[model samples]
Target: MDDLIVKTVTKLIIPFIQLYGIFVILHGHLSPGGGFAGGAIIGASFILLTLAFGIEYTKSILSAKVTERVEIGGVIWYIFIGLIGIAISGVFLGNRVAGFPMGTFGSVISGGMISLITIGIGLKVASTMISLFHHIIEED
Candidate 1:
């Protein structure tokens, strides 16, 4: 953690890693990567940070309360999106029938609620991984 090389490398690469993760999540509906892959990527970035900087430092950045809230928020967001389908189409996760606009094809925002769902899933997966990592590391 005190090594300048590792710290510098982590600082340099963490942002890009996180950016890629977000990209994966956003493009999940249109591409191969999705919530799970993107979330794992994001979680890996945090893991890298923890490895490079130490648990205490990572804790300062992402406290227990904040992580819990984020996780819960992701779950709530997912449920809310599903509820929209129920309200609109009387079916859970109803896409077009729920009146979600299918935008221009091949566009980033073209997948109706798919993008939103994946975003929520990505958040949940990322938080879950971080939490598990923290717990496992703290088990000592």
Candidate 2:
């Protein structure tokens, strides 16, 4: 069935796309890329999969309601993380005191709050994209 084929292809493609996205996000410090760029790539990857396969196929991975909730949750988490710095350091996302080390360049934990922001951005993009895809598919 088309369903099985699409499902198989989507599974095969998602990992590579997601890995590249995360690499871009995490490597933002020494490079031009950042959370936004990486997030966009990841979101676009999902869109590609959706287009290649089908919205119904994609929805099996995550429902519209789940996507909406995840989007909202990511935003709330991002805001909370940003505010934490202000509470203690008297500045929003003040990296010097957010607790994470500004370790050596290229290290696993090099930047402070950068990874957190990247993760938040990635999740936000992914969920928003899912919601959009769901809407588009529903219009049919």
TM-score for all models, in order of appearance: 0.95, 0.80
| Candidate 1 local distance difference test against the native | 0.92
Cα lDDT of model 2 by residue, 10-111, tens digit = 779888988888888877776777777887778777787777677776678766778889899889989888898888788887887866568787876778
Model 1 TM-score (2 dp):
0.95
RMSD vs true structure, all candidates: 1.1, 2.8
Query: In candidate 2, where is summed lDDT lowest over 10 consecutive residues?
Result: 1-10
Candidate 1 C-alpha RMSD relative to the actual structure: 1.1
lDDT of 2: 0.78
* lDDT by residue (tens digit), candidate 1, 1-140: 48999999999999999999999999998889999999999999999999999999999999878878989999999999989999989999889999999999999979789999899999999999998999899777
RMSD of 2: 2.8
Could you tell me the TM-score of candidate 2? Answer: 0.80
